[model samples]
Target: MKIKRAFIGLSVLCAIMLCSCSRTPGGIAPAGSPNGQASSQLPTATPASGSSDLSQSSRPDASTATSPAKPPALTQESIQIKLKQMTANEKIGQMVLAGIDGTTMNAQTKALIQDYQAGGIIFYKVNLANTRQATELINSLKDTNSRNSTPLWLSLDEEGGRVSRLPDELHKFPTNAVIGQANNEKFSFAAGSTIGLELRAYGLNMDFAPVLDINSNPNNPVIGNRSFGANAKVVSRLGVQTMNGLQSQSIVSVVKHFPGHGDTSIDSHIDLPVVQHDLNRLRSLELVPFAEAIKNKADAVMVAHILLPKIDATNPASFSKTIITGILRKELGFQGLVISDDMTMGAIATNYELGEAAVKAVLAGVDVILVGHEYEKEVKVILALRQAVKDKRISMDQLNTSVTRILTLKSKYGISDQKITEPNVAKLNAEVDKVMKLIQ
Candidate 1:
């Protein structure tokens, strides 16, 4: 039973959503902080106290959490419509997701959520070891959202094959490469349909899927068969089918590794890789699926970690405006959420300071930052973001826009409509059958 002490309870869920340095099995505390108060703006994060699986989620003490300000009471629809009218911090909170792993929240994670008002929470493998246990853990996360009257974007990387995090009982669709080998559009649709149908059964709303990478580099260490194909045309055509199938089931799909990870020999999990290809080459091969997916109105776009000399000379795709805003946003016309791949990875981890990257990412136009793996790192990142706003490195208006999109997603998925409850075992098995039939 991995477990850790949560962040201090004094954190208001709204303000706790700030920045922190990286840590595993660590809690987020400010430098020189005593009794949960950071002496200054920059707080040194503390390591989580629990076993690896039990990262600090938020303050476990429910009594100390600050009362919500009168948020002009309105129906769920109005809450969504009124989202645009929220403060910049509120909006930014919607884009930031924290990590949660437990039968229930600990004090520190609760404090972080209640303090910072994070946008969402991501579950790791340790969080899903057993189906019944996972259901309870998810219930705590959902309860946190209900208390705050905010929509929680509870997310998981449940892609089948190598990345499946859900239990064996859940429907596991075939990997993209299997379908790519078939190169059949219907197969692509079937895979996505199966994935989407199964996810909805668990009350999950967002999926980080449909890898747009072309898998051109046979020796690719990170994303081999995870991609659809080696050829851009095949990737683009099948990607469209898969994305359509996902949306048909009402599950929001994100087509990822923008500006591409198709030809990289190195994995971003350890180090940042360079694309080295020219713009024309990128457009013809790597750009096809992304361009097609955006045109199809994909819900979100996950940026890659690699550097592209032809696209941006200064930073990697995650922080490059030339690639994200100039190319992906302006040129391709993608108006949905633009997310950076996990910031705690070696790619971004080795290059920039956590706080620095957090500020720059928002400035560069990414709508969300995925940093759930390392809790201490997440705190430092969030704290740095707050400091950046104070210093005007990141504009308050931009933060608001980011948060607005998150709220819109929450409303669109109707996450608040249903409580996250464990399905009866018999019914759950039937769900697996239903999805299999849809895909088969």
Candidate 2:
């Protein structure tokens, strides 16, 4: 009887050991265990809302899971940090927006990017041939600038009527005069949007456009058809709409010839034209559109070479601290970028030495000096700016402020050095056709 009882006890002990062996080591089932009985018996976690039901093998392990890091936000502090890292030459480069000679990238252009580190390039009829050629040239320029710290502003006048610089293949819209005559806000907006769209399609990011100068002077030689209209109210209303439209397409529209270029009898491209208006006169007529533009958040204002002697007795608007910093910035309260009209224009070139004028413009709060001609002149202007900074003619604080503005604008416009594919002329034209219909 004792032996039989001992045998039963041993048999029961062996059965218990066999049951334990059937389970996985940690009281969990091996995934493919027979009948999946152990797995079926295991407790299941309820899935959270909007979460997919994941199997144990597919779920990420908390210990090893990781998330992608986000890029730092662009802010004043971040910009300051970037500014701190830039060299004097790089900072100076940010202030120059130059023009090249050829239709394609050449040694001079390459040096501008690699050596001078020019901030921007404005293309003209000389630099464009056909759609494909222009696109290739622009892409090449961008490719060359890829190694540089900041992107180039591939820009053109492209104001649609007489001032357009687009390739022959692209369709041209009516002049600002025609659009202003139409006096249709919707049509004006569409026009600006269409222009911006085509410009962006060609990888050009800036348009020196929407001549805010009211065609007040019937005999104004330079701004004849360029002005929106003779009436300030009309210019103001349509100008703002056009500006908004261009901005809609992510193109920076530079409202030009600020403090008004409408009343000048002489073409500023040839000689300096004086605006005899005092502050009150400007506030009433000439400054109406500009004031309105500023109220509507103008991105940039191009100061003309036209001298307002009554306002600043000596320097042209582009070089006058009273006009740029005092009037436009302080009085009009314009905080956006201030660009100078082409320094190579006869008004400036014939009067002031290129280098000296550039320094004066910088000191006067002009953020960008547009040197739209001659490689030699561009180089001289750059060297002059460098020397000025070194000699304390242009203070480091002032330099930083201007560079900060330039970089901030570049950031705002999402400017990049990435190469663009060939533009589809047909597609762009088709869109432009739609806009033309509206204006017509």
Candidate 3:
């Protein structure tokens, strides 16, 4: 698989990054102060909850350089313009994802986060906690970006049902496939609207929602009910409805596992699945919903870790340029974010080294690499990416193209304008009842 000539132009037109020099916020910090400095001496303060008293703490004496310097003023518009001036290498680094936990920040994660300058953060099961715990953890991470005065696109797989990270107390909706089976559009819209509201209220910017994979094979281990139905039209209608409801609340929607993973019996999480179908077969059976989503302006597309012998003999979707740029970008004309499903999983874990996949992924035209769980892994991936650009294995031009897409998603999600806030877990719980009723 080759990065075509057209791919080169993506770097110049959209790829970009920004250098943040302030006390880079959003790394691992304690509940209150990032460095664990005494709360009595907070430099600048933002309330975590609505009822909390909002007031600036007393200023520190000038002699106390230990005091927080004034929070550098950062607005979303300013960051976008600054990113445009960045180098391609920096831009590529910005698109890598380093998974993070709430309670503690590892030095390795911190270093990768600071240096790689990843575009977004995704939370996993291990990373979750109670509302207070989540609020503090995300707040601390957001602080690092705030120090740079750049808002980070904090993301989560709060899809409700089996995949919810934050629990029912924190909000969880019924699975989409469940909702879709109900054959009620109002029920679908309500469920989707609630999911959108809960996500945004938490300061999270994106949802890997409304799974477009049609679940054509009931025996398919990974994507069974994750899809709405066996029929493409039914899935498309529900997926688009879910996408619309989510975007209506300004929460960015990602229709995923793209080019489609519906009929395969193999589970990608355990091993890479190969779909041996021709282009026509894909368009008619699997690509139906994804094609509609691309036309509908879905903000991002999550590349599944499956391999398709028909599309490319060697590379899986994540590392394949043909799947991303050729089919999705060139053929479908999707000009949005391209993020990989977590590279930490066995499918990728069993095949390539983490860093190897990271570098190849960016070069493959993915806007971001999702690496959850290990910080050392994230760092290794980052350093590897940096070295590839240094060694000219992954061109600076290639890196820039992906970065541009990353920033555009951030700008569209409203992350730049809003601070990460505590999500309304209780409200999410109320919707779960509504969703369960419809799905049931």
Please tell me which predicted candidate would have the highest lDDT against the true structure. Answer: 2
Query: All candidates' TM-scores?
Result: 0.78, 0.83, 0.78
Per-residue lDDT for 203-294 in model 1, tens only?
56577888889999999999888887798888888887777766655567878889889899889999989888988898888888998887
Q: CA lDDT of each candidate? A: 0.65, 0.77, 0.64
What candidate 3 gets wrong by more than 4 Å, as runs, is 1-81, 84-89, 417-424, 431-440
Candidate 3 lDDT for residue 127:
72
- Between prediction 1 and prediction 3, the one with superior lDDT is 1
Two-way TM-score contest, 1 vs 2, winner: 2
lDDT of 3 at 352: 86
Q: Write the per-residue lDDT of candidate 3 for residues 368-421, one digit (tens) a residue.
A: 788876777777777888888889998766666566566545544435422445
What candidate 2 gets wrong by more than 4 Å, as runs, is 1-73
